[model samples]
Target: MKNKNLSYKFYVIMSLSIAAIPVVFIVLSYAMFFTHLGITSLFNIDNHFSGSVLTTYFYIVFFGILFGLMFIAAKYFKKIIHRINTMEQTVRKIAEDDAFPEKLAVIEESEDELNKLAASINTMIDRLRAKEMELSQMEDLKREYLKQLSHDINTPLNALNLELYLYSQNHNVSKEEVDVLYQKVDYISKLVNSISSEALFDIDNYYIFKEDISVHKSLKQTINKWSYLLNKNNIEYTIDVQKNLIWQANELWLDRLFENIISNIFKHSATNQIVITVGDTLIIKDYGVGFEIDRDHETTGLSVIKNICQKLNIQLDIESTNAGTAYRLSQE
Candidate 1:
């Protein structure tokens, strides 16, 4: 950015140069005094002309001229110095008040250098004000869209969850399936709430992530929750786990990660046995009839897994074959 103040070096140099002029003159005056003494001795004069009116007049005129020069120098620098100070104040006002200088306070309408500078500054100020107004309108629109979109989508979701809850009361419905339905409802509810509470639409605010999660504890709970769900289907599973590992993460999100993965296994895999391990990485392997990952399908859990892992800065790797399917989630 261009500086708002004029360079002070120019004025400083000029002032110093102006002050030196009198020193040079004074040295010449002293030299003339010595020469006059030489002349008096050569002429054999008994008394010096130091008290003479002519000598007094010479001193008076020399000092008078020196003072006059100083006065003129001060007067000349004053207006430029004042303009620089005023420009600095104007910069501050433009920043804080977002207001341009008053018309009278501007250097002038005439085409002087200072006036030209004021014109440029005013132009910049106008552009800044316009850009700010544009950004303000954009933010307002974004917030309104988030507000309406959240309402429109969640409204139907709320009605659907209530219907599902009421339907789960029937004797024909399996309690395990009902539990899964409730989990779905809870997941959707949390997704909405997270977006709303996090000010995800408010991009201007700085974001601070809070993890404070004991990885071992949270992942163990997640596994146990899925174990219960899977055990109901008579599917056997074994776990190998490490102790006392902790990192930054949300427990619910951790649960969501494992929940989605396990839920996919149950829905698609006919496997009776699975093994899970937790250490430097989370590894889940199933000896299921592995299916090909169809890229056209959004219903697959891969996309959600990809997203959450990214948010948590965890690396996800997948391997599948005719014999088995394996998933690995680890930190980088």
Candidate 2:
């Protein structure tokens, strides 16, 4: 792979042609001298042929060599110009379309400066495409996350509003009711902080903040928080999570994971009895009309749940039928 620049090629051709000039001139001078002597001595001919005939021969030879050199230079330069033109057209096309192709055409046979430039452009296009894909995926994740976040925030907000309304009607708020309000307010505050700080969206920090958390405690607290809605709907539920069941997980994300699961149960599982067990595995079964898993169940809540489970290395399995729906989550 001998790469050559335009200057190097041009210099080589020009140097050879220029260096032949003195040699050609010296050879012509000797030929003219010997021809004049030989013709006059051997044939007794006149010396005027050197001026007329030999001079004409010299001019013809010199012009013929000049023409041959020019022809070679033209042919070589033509190929270089064509390559340059092709590169220019490619660049113009990309600029006009405002997009990069997957690859650039490179002349592998000739490792010239132009080929190297093309290879560089190809590398740059690959990097740009990768960056584009990353940004696009992030945008999609952000969009889905925001949808799920709004849904999660709405539950506590509605509870808080309902509690406030009840207090206004009675003109007296009980201690338990006040505690519930405080908890709802605290949860909403955390949601706001998480949103403002971009905690959930920050991939590097969110999944790394793990700790040992009691499964029973977290589930119990989530159920208590959503008690207002469950009671209003008259939905009966049972929990079998052991107090000793502790898992190493991201506490905030675990809370969110449970919250989304419960919220989905409340919204989609139109069942009266909900059973949750956390022993060797976690299972949330509802005795309601189940949904078809093969359908487009791309709800924000489910998306959030799946995202959390995937990032936390949790395996999720869903079973659904006309009899009921059950979601099982376990460590893998």
Report backbone clashes per prediction.
Answer: 1, 0
Mark the regions of model 2 whose C-alpha exceeds 4 Å error after superposition: 1-170, 199-207
TM-score of each: 0.56, 0.55
Native-to-model Cα distance after best TM-score fit, residue 80 in candidate 2, in Å? 15
Candidate 1's residue-wise lDDT over 140-185, tens digit each?
A: 7867877787788788888987787778765567776666666666
Best by TM-score: 1
TM-score of 2: 0.55
- What's model 1's overall lDDT? 0.71
